[model samples]
Target chain A: MRILALPPEAPPMLRRLTSGLRRAALGAGALGVAAFAPQIARAATVHVTVAYYSAATGPYFKQMAAAFEKTHPGTTIKIDVVNWNNLQQVLQTDVSGGVPPDISIIGTRWLLSFVKDGIAEPLDSFMTPAFRNRFIPVFLKPGEIGGKVYGLPIAASARALFYNKTLLTKAGFPNGPKTWNDVIAAAKKIKAMGAYGFGLQGKEIETDVYWYYALWSYGGHLMGANGKVAFDSAAGVKALTLYKTMVDQGLTEPGVTNYTREDLQNLFKQGRLGMVITAPFLIGQIAKEAPKLAYGIVPVPTGTVQSTYAVTDSIVMFKASKVKKQAWQFLDFLFTKDNRVLFNKNEGFLPTTRAVAADPYFQDNKQLQVFVNLLPKAHFAPVIRGWENVAKAVIDAVQSVYLGKAQPAAALKTAATSADRALAQ
Target chain B: MTASARRAFAPRMLIAPSFVLALFIIAYPFFDIARMSVYHVSRFGILGGFAGLANFRRIFADPVFIATVWRTLVWTGAVVSGTILVSLPVSLVLNENFHGQGLARTLVMLPWSVSLTMSAIVWLWSFDANHGMINATLQSIGVLRQPVQWMARASTAFPIEILVGILVSVPFVVTIFLGGLSSIPSDIYEAARIDGAGRVQQFWRLTLPLLRPFISLAVVLNVIYVFNSFPIIWVMTQGGPAEGTQILVTYLYELAFRLGRPGEAAAVSLAMLAILMVFTTIYVRMQMRSAEP
Candidate 1:
């Protein structure tokens, strides 16, 4: 009867009352849930932070984060971009401060130390059997410590020799050197042609560590089965002697001792160096910054074995992270074939998954494929707990040897002694 | 309360906030660093079990640490002496009532206003081996055919750093000396002239002695600043060209941050702090001696 004779304002009031009643019913339902479980009363958005490198790779990560948020409506993902020089310190400080990013791209060489410190959470518990089998085996090795997986490789890079094609041709070697002896001969030829035969980072850790890539290729072992410094072995001494001879022969730049990655890259771009052993990730940067250089990427020259240093970037969860589940969700999403293709495409990273590497995007890329081919032959750095100290000692000794202040045998001995002492610490 | 009590109470209140500030700003960090220095903290800065004197022993045994200490001393000495000697004349010129004295004074102090890192970058570009402005200018003037690789060579790298340090620090030194010069009444110079004292004699006997306090203050400041300098040396060479440019601060930064040897870095920093305390003690003594009747 009231509806039959309803005033115009009464209908509006009735509509409002009905909507308010519905909201109150929903609120009571939510309160019922809260009363049943107190934890639900404090339910909050789980914020996960993921970090990556590569100025070009930041946007892809953001897109991945967006997709992850879309898939899980209530969760959020944060992406942090770090430059190479500061990444190690930033990660160290965060983990050490007990407030690490939920997931981060840690250097493969840095994983052992992080794992040893108990800062990296073992991902084995989270990874399904199918997920574990997706990546290349070498890509899996860096994140493995004591047979426990602490990280999962997302993007990878490998070191190889880059040569100036025109310079190599002028030096009577149309193709890049395939062996150490040939490299030296070609370097000397280039030196005679008024160009630096080679570019090497003789000053910093690059001297000791990068040269080890060459040494291992020549059947050298930095640490023997006993795990002591074995750089004084026959192969180690030969590797060091060859390096010193190149410097003495004026086949390398006089200022080689001062070169870092930036310096080496610039010199190569300027046609001052015939060849440099650098990572495949540099190709994209070179193409962008100096597009005119006629260059070739080949396998790192061999001594007796075909080997190269493989660097992997892995997404590691922090031990203290509260949003680890969300972090894993984001990590799993990142390695899916489609996302991996986008990530590896713009970033110049080799996809960790063999299937992703075989995608049409990477299959036809000749320069990129050479690096892809080397994936099987790649070896990771030593996974010792105190590898940083050992690496620094070895670098200092190499510097001493290169500067002619100490003999190679003595320097390597000192390095090994110090390294052993550090390992003990 | 009586008027005297009220005044005393107000003064105490005025100083109370500062005391609280001192506890938070100075005492807290001092005690923290001291605590960290003695502990064998892991690279992650978490507390590992204590090992007495282990870190100090490790630091002493490190050749790079020893080299860095010597380098820090050399850098401090160079910056202090270079800053004072150069700025002394600059302040003298500025103190004279010459034309454009205001502009000259401002220009002399301009570098002090720029941050150290910015100054380092500017100087680095000027000193670059190839395509640097300095080299370009020198080449245009037919000074040399080949550009000098100023930062690449071991011998030139530290010298270049020292030169830049001197350039940045001289402005502050000159300004402080100018203040000292101004406080000495003009009548003193007039009296010396009237007494038939030559300009050289007056400067050595009168002006030098009068400026001693300022010189001591500037030396202490310069030494502390130059010894603690990291950005300039780090940006230019990063203790490189075979660690030729390494000073104490850069060495500590590399060891702690780059090499992940916090224990060694902390030990070296404590040793440096000990050295600087000695410098500060000596400075206080000099100040006391100068202030004596």
Candidate 2:
């Protein structure tokens, strides 16, 4: 259409118009490709859904997901942080609904149930000997149900006696209690100083576990060789009586039946409680929430044996998950030395891996050292079906005894029956 | 289309969406629950074939379930009756010509506007043995020698739970009663007065009979709501201190969600539904009777 030939370099406006058209065409082409890029990438991307409980540590999960995505390129990790109280229900519901997440961080006690239900994927194929050896054996043992590894311990905690150092000193004890009797005596002394001597969690959720710390200390077990509840033994009665005596003597806080583990921790953090038995998570919380309050951690006072509750949350892959390999990758990423150390340090959980535990970050800390040393002596709750219901029965019995509604021997006997019933169910 | 055809199809077309919605939302789930009640559903919700009436038999045989049923009945009766009693007086006061009457009516409705969980939490704080306002005030005034652990003991917990239920429920009942009170013509009261009726007589003879429909409605609705109420007991006591306050709904929740026994939970739900249906039938009968001349 060039009726009139122009110079090689045309008018400024015309040059600009040609260049603009060229740029627009290029931009359109680029935009078209850009628009389809995500779709194409998404087709290749492996979507892994990770469900865990830690409302407080949600941001850390997002960070971990982002880090995983960045390194893995065409992969995505979706994180769901369910409330700890509702994790089991939600996970079960999700599993039943056939839309379960690819990976789930579940209570260690649930591993057997999940395995028995056939929803949990065996991770032995993914976990090599080197990788298996990386984890602390005790923490890893719960994840193994019947010689098949269904889960990996992602976070763990060992219950220990947390004493308010200032309160203990104020009550004429410079250090923490050395024995159960010392605890009672110090508690009485602290109560005289206008603070609760012992903060007992008599409520449902962890009440049974708290009772176990005492029960196991007295060399009692939840089940015997025949797999029946053996908690009605003399040791169990003694354990219940210990708590009952403390409450009756006004050494523990009033309304012990209403106190949750967290509530007791809060009371202790406020310097109003002389001693509490809880996990190492409280150390981080107390350091952050109550920095001015000095505290000490020790193994739970021995009755006939030295024992504490060792609780672990494990990560397992769902059998229905399509991206098992990618899920394993993320799981492996989570337990890597640096990530494990950082995550545990931030989340106030004990490291599941030996490498992380051996890190100076955990070694040099005196408060964490007590819990770390107690790990070997820690006892997990019986990993039996209907343990939750059994625990509820024990909680009821303990609460009744604490409230003086029943005698320890009778309550323990009844609780034992109830536990047996629950086990049989 | 012909005009006749269009007219004939119009109503059905207009109602089709809601009908389908009701089918999916209400009928489907209800039938599913009914089916679940007859089967042995596992923890994974796998139906383990027909269990016949075993679930129902087991629940009925269980002493705890029997206790829960009785508790549920007691909870419904006490809460509904308490609501009516408290609301009737407040609604009457609100209906009268008085200073701050509008403000009083609004204030009376405040608790109704708050969600049950929020109110339960507020009440939880108030009933805290050591730091709750009720305990603190009672102790300060020497009414309590020590801070009584209200929710920690079954005896005290049950009453406080009922009281909290009434607290949350009374506002709704008051508003309903107020609506009923306003609808009654003043002329009837005037006529009663002209016939030598005192204020008490006028209220007793005229106000009550005329408000019968509303009172029945309030009672029926309150019965359902209080029967199905979960939060007040859950947040306050968690049906605890030995499952003392565990009613039908909380027990169902524990059975289904906590214990992972959907079949048993569904049985409990069906039992609850049957009991509620009886009340519903009575309410409908009363409504029909009231509607007639």
Candidate 3:
């Protein structure tokens, strides 16, 4: 037995088994190294989280991410889509939990509070002069707070007077209203046609925004030069009076107090409403959902001034993000000519970049061009810290006037008082 | 270890994870909220230093908060009483020897299975001003000349909200009443009938007395649930039309999430907790008294 062991195998079967075992071990070692080799060679991917609202624009974001990742290898973009109504609460929760996204698209009005709270990182360092000059100057105003740029306007919107052409022609007004008086007169005629004339949104979310269209058109500002509540002025009363008169004259649906923006848009799409002051996005929705309904888009009918509410969604970098450089790179990639145009086209928002705005793709679109023309006359909502409370107060005041619970002046005064208190806080 | 000690240790070890989970989930949050009630927490959740009872004082001083508290009580009372009134008769029908008793029970339980948010959404569509089923039916039947916007005005919105609360709460309330009815011995009803008692008399003396515990449980639970209910009012109206439908819970939500004043929200929460605790204590006392032989 000792002699057989020293010779390594007494039988051919034993020798064959030993050779097979050695081969298997070598193969296993080679496979292990091969599996780990790529992991060792490639650097760890930098993940950047970007939060945005709008389910409609989610696909464009995904496309943007794919394009960005193709150009920048070893970097990934995580898109967090939140509902617009819950965006603030979700972002606040994320911030309190110490896990805010690397980048986010926030409401333009929220830029001030975010900066004050140190939630937004100043983009002055990341923004080059060329890049700074790329955005429309007026569109960038809200993003700048206290002499620092905390956000970059990614998407911009200006409210337009969208009219159901079929309803307008049936009401004997082939052309849509051109002035506030004409709108009121046309609304009465439309109401006589057994359909609601003007679809008014009076409830939460964009209630204040709807109010702003009339307020800005009537030459009212939310705050005066001294930073006191200014919506209680004469212009504010006129704005509120316009809405009350619409309701009183039976020009709007009886349930204007509860009508949401979508509710009004739906009525417009169904041809039950003659006119509505809404964003360009409603055009896309109407075209898709109610293709038979002929519609017209125009600059919102003027009061004292021919201005519309202009709101922008801006891309903001968070201070807590470890991938700030990568996030900035992705933002730059997103603002490219083709990407910006496609994104704005898909969203029905005006292009924020000057180059994209001047491009033939956006310039040639008549409906979009209407909004682009109105951009110079657009007025942004106040971007103060407590503007949400002010917005709430404005909504309440307008609802009170619409519901016949208070006079426009009294309601505006009460709203101003409440807003002043909120601002103080 | 001794056998008794080993047995106790084994059970404790088995329960340790769950006990820790409960402490983290319930006890920790409760204590943290209590602490926050007295401190000034900013919109960003930074502690703005000790504020003592300033938040509570501010809440108490606010007329809106006072009105919200009153409105919450009214909502809770209306919802709980309405639920009991509806569920009692439904449970009586359910307890009968019907052919499709099992099917009836399951069908009635469907509303409870549907999420509150989903129910609110469904109700919103049904109560829609222009194209809702309710409005269309009312108009077709000549009950309404013009469609009423159910969620627009405070007067209509409040009643509609209560009706919604009753609809959602009836399933669970009916189940509890059914359980109570089943547990009562048949012989007791027989004995009452033999003693010359009628159906109404039997219900009052025997059925109702036996169902006291279940009724108390239902009332207490419904009180808590309705008082703390948020999504229904939130989804339906968002406490709008000049904050007419603003209850304590919705007000607290606005304060915490919308207004970004967590400290005041905590105070509001603690105030709600105090009210609930009082009701719970009374419920516990009644339950203990009922348990006596």
Q: What is the lDDT of residue B74 in candidate 3?
A: 91
The candidate that achieves the highest lDDT relative to the unseen native structure? 3
A55 in model 2: Cα distance from truth in Å? 6.5
Query: Model 2 chain B — which ten-residue stretch has the worst lDDT?
Result: B55-64
Question: What tens digits encode model 2's per-residue C-alpha lDDT throughout A210-278?
Answer: 888888999988888999988888899999899888888899998888888888988988888899998
Q: DockQ for all models, in order?
A: 0.40, 0.54, 0.63
Q: In candidate 2, which residue pairs clash? A: none
Per-residue alpha-carbon lDDT of model 1 for B141-237, expressed as tens digits? 9997877768765588889899998999999899899999988877888999999999999999899989988888888887888889888898888
Q: Quote the positional error of residue B234 for candidate 3 in Å.
A: 1.6
Error of 3 at A13 (Å): 60
lDDT of 3 at B207: 83
Off by over 4 Å in 1: A1-52, A203-205, B1-17, B137-145, B290-293
Across A143-202, the per-residue lDDT of candidate 1 in tens digits comes to: 888889998887688888999999999877788889888888899899888888988787
Candidate 3 residue-wise lDDT, B1-293, digit = tens = 89999989998999999999988999988998989888978777867779999999888977778888888889999999999999998999899998999999999999999999999999989998877999999999999998898988888998899899999999999989999999998998888788999999988888888898899889988898999999899989888888889999999999888888899999999999998899789878978886888
Give the per-residue lDDT of model 2 (tens digit) for B12-85.
99999999998899999899999999998877787887999988987887667999999999999999998899
